[model samples]
Target: MFTPVTIETCITFHGHVCGGISLGYVLANYAMDKLGAQRGDDLYARMECQNCLVDGVQCVTGCTTGKRNLEIIPGGPMALTLVRRDTGKGVRAVISVDMPHGLSKEEAKNHILSLDPAAICTFEEATLELPN
Candidate 1:
């Protein structure tokens, strides 16, 4: 059965650049779509996820126009969540990809090593809410 889902993600960048927000939004949307497709589901028919990036300066100036570069964590595992909505039959799933800033190979390795694997596992497990 076809169901309706809405997913919204907001990312904030702290720098002077253009299109970072929009780029992030695009990347996020693409990631979500890909995730859904891989799971044998149609994203267009069952889900709606919107991505938004906001710059610090433009947010303050209220200009509503800015471009910026986005640094996404590459080669990391993507997170997916499926939540049941109030309609009782509808489902919403969110796919999140963490794009870290550009780092040297060594630095990136070290950063990953520094994280607590157990915590990461817990967070990943908590993202999903299936229908009853």
Candidate 2:
């Protein structure tokens, strides 16, 4: 059986979750599929965004810096890359589109703060390599 990662789970890991982290969870799964891999016993999550989104990836993927399964590079385009620890196969995840709710900036903040998954993020996938 397969169960999807939920926003509640992200909240527990983040201690303060947001749509970005929730999206990270989804994107991580998507990236795994694109890379012909699964979370399995070992994997690497390469991240670009330094925002709250990283929290979700850390929790859902079980690939945190503490475990040496994650490597983050700050000050770049907001993106994430996952590598298989054994095979070296990898995929990069990037947000291609950010859905808008026609609300003011403040409203957007309120919505995110309210734990809304209303913000839809479309992704464009690419095959990539994590440095060996």
Candidate 3:
């Protein structure tokens, strides 16, 4: 079985697990599965915000800023577009639910992790023009 990277891995990279990391972990896996992508594939990630979620995306997709494959554009929303460089095709996952308020950090993380990708995000097909 191809085990998807666990949330614990993202938590280790992110220094802590929170709602954003949980959401990112779930959505990144969903996007990769939908696109038939594996970690370290020739993929590009365009992120819409800078937050803990970025770390989760980085951890799961292996598309890091240092590798110049992940770009943060600061669009003021929690969203990500993961594109396959070879095909210019991708999936965009936009946050559709607000992070639950008044919950402990661990509680929030667990709650977000439990949600289906469709429950926390709305996904759309995307086409990207990536550099060679």
TM-score of each: 0.21, 0.69, 0.91
Q: What lDDT does the true structure give each of the candidates? A: 0.29, 0.63, 0.84
Error of 2 at 131 (Å): 7.6
TM-score winner = 3
Best by lDDT: 3
lDDT (C-alpha) at residue 92 in model 2: 75
Tens digits of per-residue lDDT, candidate 1, 1-132, equal 423221121222333322334333333333334333222231111212222332221222121222211122233333222222222222222323343368653454345334443322222112223213
- Give the Cα-based TM-score of candidate 3 against the true structure: 0.91
Q: Give the residue spans of candidate 3 off by over 4 A.
A: 1-3
In the range 1-132, model 2's lDDT, one tens digit per residue, is 234456577777777644566556666655665666644546788788777678877766777888777888887665778777676666677755462368664454455445422233334444345545
Show model 1 residue runs off by greater than 4 Å: 1-77, 80-97, 123-132
Q: Please give me the total number of clashing residue pairs in predicted model 2.
A: 0
Among all windows of 10 consecutive residues in model 3, the one with the lowest summed lDDT is 1-10
Ordered list by TM-score, greatest first? 3, 2, 1
- For model 2 the local lDDT of residue 57 reads 78
